[model samples]
Target: MEPSNKINFSRRSFLKTSALASGGMLIGFNLFNACKQDVKMPVDLSTLNYNDFNAFIKISPEGKVTIFAPNPEIGQGVKTSMPMLIAEELDVLWDDVYVVQAPLDTENYTRQLAGGSQSLRLAWEPLRQTGATAKQMLVNAAAAKWGVNASECKAKQGVITNANGETLGYGDVVLEAAQLEVPENVTLKKPEDFTIIGQGTANVDIDEIITGKPLFGLDYKEEGMLYASVLRPPAFGQVLDTFDASEAKAMPGVVDVITIGDKAKAYLESEKPNWTAQLSKSKKVVVLAKTTWDAFKGKKAIRATWKEESALESTEFHNEKLNEILEGSKFNTRRKDGDVKKAFAQADKVLERTYEAPFLPHNTLEPMNFFADVNDEKVRLVGPVQTPEDAAKTVAALLGRNIEDITVEMTRMGGGFGRRLYGDFVYEAAEISDKIKKPIKMVSSREDDMTTGVYRPSTKYKIAASIKNGKVTGYHLKEACINGNMYGLIPNFFPAAAIENYQVDTANYKSNITTGAWRAPYTNFLASAEQSFFDELAEELGVDRVQLHMDLLENVKNNPDPKIEYSPDRLQGVLKLVVEKANWGKTAEGTYQGLAVYYCHNTHVAEVADIEMNNGVPTVKKVTCAVDCGIVVNPLGALNQIKGGVLDGIGHAMYSDFVFDNGVPQSNNFNSYQLIRMGQTPKVDVHFVKNNIAPTGLGEPTLPPVGGAVANAIYKATGQRLTKQPYMNNLQAKKVVG
Candidate 1:
């Protein structure tokens, strides 16, 4: 169940507050404190009138409000939308507010990271309450000056008006508000009353982004900072053995050549499981130079030899191992319900299919880069990172310094997509700086980023279903992947409780290739496989595809499982909404349509892809999507996310393929790799399910369903099942029956 957004005032206590140096007010409070019954003693606002509070809001003397957005903005629009939550309750005009990225402050913020799409979902209540409480404090101050009951005064658009119609700007009573005791509770604005939210607001960084401002990590620079280009092992199972840097040291503008990562190697050898540890390369050769070009040139001059430490695994090897695992019965059962053996034995017919996907690189627009200055006093790190707290912790551990001694500043990321979450580049920058005792900016070429960066795990799923009396009696799903499986995370997702006899088994073949989250993670491919399987299932049962989904959802709703990870009502809502919006089952003469619905990252999304045959090839023309992520914070940003995700999902499923030859990446650059171009992008029509429930994530949920919709649509147009990713490749390999 979704948590209530209603604020409980009696149990809440303000944390800190201060009068701004610029003759304004600053308020800091922990919204989570409302959950605690025992209220802590409020700090004396009068004594703590200094400008050092970890405050979210700063009201200037001119009535302008600067809201510090506390989450990393990786083009997810949190920098703009998160502050909207505060400004909405603060009763400030959207134009009167300015949003700024907050620094990494564990004391003042929670969940500063940007993965999992949980930013807005987790911040919904507390951020609203923070703004509401500040508004109430302003109201109290105005009421005190006017000699009227605080309840008689109402605040709107940064102004307070009393019963007699006298008005005081928020700036006018800033000092008094700073001295006033924080109100334990404040009334929040209803959904219908929201003016800034639910309305289309331009992204806060749109101007800077379009104007080519220095907002990305690649644009960050400091005087006297050296540039670094590192050479790592060419393959996954290889380790850096030795390197001769004399020739590189003699290159033009080359400052120094150093080797680092001994400490990282020791840490990895300790057998301690850590996300950062998995990212760290045990040894590397860094070429520090006066310029980025010089660094690159020097790096090219270095001759390094690597020693094989383990099997040099390739894509063919991965495919063999995965297929072997799926074919074998030695599997760990993730979930089992009812009697699968009996149901299958008594079944009249059985249908089974396997879906396969290759490993994928993040391929972020901006290659990995970071700036770090490690001095005896403190460590200053600045870059675009999804997980600043984790990066800081990793740097502190590597440098043998206290985490408090490190400060991290987040720049707007060009694109993360879970790549920057690892912070491998950040560690390298800090390690290089600590070794040379000078600030350094570490940058990775596109080849370096693609060949050596962490990747999305390759996976295969075998789904089997038993049919009796034209109804699915038993369902079994087995997943085989490289490095890890999704059983622990999504065992109770859709299709778990919908079927009477359901069982999920998972097995994995551990490889030396590093794999981590990529966008929606497992669901990015799982949804495609599951949705395509459902379409095939519908055909096998001689039922309408949409009707089959409705039946399964109805089963889930009627016999609700407490452990089910999705809301049947919500899932059904999007499915029905999309069906109506997209005019499902009705298409033009040349257009064939297919639909898919999925729930993940706390959001429910439904998509319908419209495809047309062009020269015996299925081409996507348009995509209609419906999303239920609770209340829409910024319609414009929400629309951007939907469209971007749809296009990204379609492009990757149709073209993005990453393979390895003996652990060496075959597609390192765009010359060999393929991406969807503007001409190929389909028109995406996005609609949202109107609700007052607290907002959920939108960044990733919209992506996971698009691949399924596209694949199913291709099947409808070509009469061929696409069981492999890079659907274009698979489609071309098979005859197109139109």
Candidate 2:
């Protein structure tokens, strides 16, 4: 019951036909590299079968190859780059290949989540194997027909040729190939032979995007789908007391006014597992209508009373609690090396600085929307979800249905930035549809999307550096924030492994405001604080900023530590490359340059931002970034992602922050909050370190360094070192877009 005309292999008849075909290989691979699945895969595969895979390519009778990308594409270019891996190994021309977005099928595609920027890293080998295995099967099919050894035949650009000058297009031999048993051991192509991996390529959907095709979650539609809008509380930790929807229910086109309290309660107390039930337990009243405007109008007309929990407090109260925790000596140590106290006490001078970053909302372009149809037979949901399998599980838990009965199809996300990582929206949509026993499309307005919970946590880092005779002798960092210890904040955040006497202390502040990963997660704010501290330390020691970082990296390189997760060589590699490209030592009039480097998501990135002060307001003119994420799959796509990350980082650091008053967010819409406009965006140049390493993630690694780079550049321009974020606060002047 698919809405689109695209071919789907999950249908029972397609599998039966494929299984009957000769020499066709249906291979299903798991994300064994991530999620702690350390079982070694052997080449021996006498037990291999076509039913064991979730995604595969089939060569039709017309020489067309369609590769399915399992992971969600949140503007990260995964939808195109993943197919490139298959095409490169399959020896097929890019034009001959078509890419398909795979629906969530955990039985076939295990570990199908796109967080941590591990999509490319995890899929690199398995996808290549899928293509290579199919290619080997096709080559064998051609060899059997030619009565020659398989090695003598080669697959090139969807055609198989023999040494005797015999040639057959892959479409001609696919039926024969589908009948043969799949080979266990298939050779993969070397990097030197890659014709498409490193080349610049446009997104596959660019044409559709330019022509205004329906590809995103917001564009989803159906014949009998009803529009829905929910009336949620004004803030987090608030409960709906009562609702009077008489006026709304009597309005034109209004179908129903349903309260979500009973469904939410049943979900939490249901027999199904409640792994994420707490997140999905939000209570709201839904308005179902014939159209989106009717639903929105009905929602606005509804009268509701909300009661704020007594424990939930204001932003000022939370900051006070944060300050109290920072001042308190009781702290949990995450990382520690040499005696930091002795090093600090004996050093010639000790510099201390505290940096703060506020909560940020994921302002996705499309907002949150999902189409769900739930009935006694089955439940089907489709929308822009980063983790479709997880969303299915959540819906299954909520609806008391089998996971297999819940079908969750992923659509192209307008933006993710980790906000879509949660399946609450999907669960919400499913519960409403199941309650109404009809297909419903739940859409979130910009205000609903922004004011809802799950924002980037407001964090503060108190850093102390001990300097003796122009060298950093010791470093201590105490991070005070809500759930700092839980959200992957390790002891060796940055500069910790580089310094000998280093320690990381953390204090957790209690708050009702929800926070989740935004872009690079903790590294985003950490880089802003750590890199700015290094700049301050460089100035205090009378050393160049670029040289100062090099010295620390040299120390880490020469003296390695096991606690350090990043390679000093890689960190140094990007720093050197970016400094050279930015012309660090050289200066131009009307511009000041600042540099910063960070390692995360198995990738190292260095950014140099050039800023110009106009009427005391800083305007970023240009940015040069160098990244080392191993092989660049689709250089053009990678460059676009990097540029987008840079602009995203600058925009968030410059103006994005969620303010709360009595547990309610103040910045509800664009009018209150500012986003980086086209005029304010800087010209960007991106470069990648040439290496033979496997490709890592590019979705978020480039973002962590942009804020620090721009902040350091602003310091150089204004001489005033602004400690707090939204550095524009220091100027107290209006934001000038240039």
Candidate 3:
């Protein structure tokens, strides 16, 4: 289940602050526009406060609607885009809706996470309901005043008007509406009646973001705040042997050097954590700091050794074991359709392929950071966190504080492709706060953040397909990897891939490398293997890749891929839509190349990548995409996410990945790792399959397909199927790294 509650946001309590968040200005909407109600929807609060405010929104005496955003904004545009969701249903002018961060009350918030592309999709139902419900309540209140049947009154753009056209603004009836019981149900406007749902609303926080507003963890500047940094073992499980802090203490801006070697509990359990977890390990650490830089920079001054576990390296962290296990391992047969072995044997042609993807980092633009002030009595935390409830619980358990004693204020994230969802770093912050007996803000350098990240585990895919008489017959997908006990998590993780004679067999290679959610997680990896493999199989059968996939997808749409608990209609729809948009298999002139698509999250997305090999460097000129996620909370916002996801994937495929030696991570800074720059942004065309389906996630599903598309296009250009990531260097080493 794509449940946001997985992070346990329900466990935390919010400590109310006297500070009023802020006011929002609503933009004008087209009035008198005819609207239809094609899609039935729930009308009421869409999101909850991380605090105990079940009402995600409230209308002030001035008619301003205040929406409490549950998810951290983190450069995902939720800060601006989500509020638009609430406002769309509330039937208020954009100018009149003000947005604020929901306080830390896990029970009140929806999902504080910014991954899975679900922020908008999942929130669509509740947020729209929130606005619609409030609108109904106000309309009723207005009707009671004007003595008209509620049906005779229409609430639009903050005004409740009679059929005769007499009206009162929302502010005029605010008190009565607030006192009235929240409505039991309400009807939403039809798409034709839409005034704001799909409009190109600019980011609500653009001014703040552009003006260097103090809205992020880095902007946190409370007085008496001390900065902290930790020196963790290079790898998890290794124990710190010796520490010499003499030189670190003598450094300028250096206050003190501290050592912590814990055999009982890793890092002191504090009612308040330091909010800076340098690394993920059950092991303890040594601390040094005067300034964050001094603490962070002093790592060079300390001499430490670790007793590495022999099993650390002995337990192979690769898929060679996976190949061994998949061929001989006793796996639960996920699907057995039409005697796949018999079908393969009868086929005129049989193809087998194996693909692998290394571990990936959730390189959020904003490094993970948190500010904490923990004392014996209570602890306060401020940063970007996906699961406040989990963070609070972890802090409480570590610090011996009641859940009520901890307060987590989630800030706008710089960007979180599933990285901030993990609560470990937040736990670390809480620990440091309690340890130092003072409030501390821990800032993770990009180096620390990227290297210490929980990665998308390396994965392997072994596949075979049968092509008979220019027709595809059977398919097999064998997947292997570890993060969760994959052996147990698949009917859930790769349902689509595990269809047909699909077998999901996994072997664990647990390591000190912290692992957490990264966008669509394993699905992205499988998309490359499954989609690309399917593309090749189609070619083998003398068919267009699009036509081939459409055939398979049509078969699986309702046939129910046994390995998948969910049907594949959504995936089929997106695949069809993208192919149509890209004009798949149609000859295109010039140096451009072509590719196909795949799905992730609950959403479906497909893309056709066009590239020109210039000086051996692949110049991605344009990308055409199609997505079907049901409703559009904000079409502009949705499209931007698709565009951004594509670019991110393009950038990673070109120049991002971590390398390590003897357990120490390489590619620490920008020099080692390169981000996509303005010079390389390809033109992206996003086509949405407009429908009334409850929205699904958009942030991640669009990403996975792009990497393979680019690779496929490069294959078309160079005739070499490039399988490895950050293919830029190899291309560039051949003198074409763009």
* Clash counts for all predictions: 0, 13, 46
True lDDT of residue 389, candidate 2 = 79
Model 2 lDDT per residue over 366-389, tens place: 899999999999898899988787
Minimum summed lDDT over a 10-residue window in model 2 is located at 1-10
**Model 1: which ten-residue window has the lowest total lDDT?**
33-42
The superposed Cα distance between candidate 2 and the true structure at residue 222, in angstroms, equals 1.9
Q: Which candidate's lDDT is highest?
A: 1
TM-score of 3: 0.85
What is the TM-score of candidate 2? 0.92
Candidate 1 vs candidate 3, lDDT winner: 1
Among residues 3 or more apart in sequence or in different chains, the pairs in candidate 1 whose N, CA or C atoms overlap within 3 Å are none
Off by over 4 Å in 3: 1-51, 107-111, 163-165, 261-290, 310-323, 330-338, 482-501, 557-577, 586-592, 729-738
Each model's lDDT: 0.85, 0.79, 0.64
lDDT (Cα, tens digit) per residue for candidate 3, span 549-600: 6666666664654445433666666677777777665646545455656655
Better of 1 and 3 by TM-score: 1
Name the better of 1 and 2 by TM-score: 1
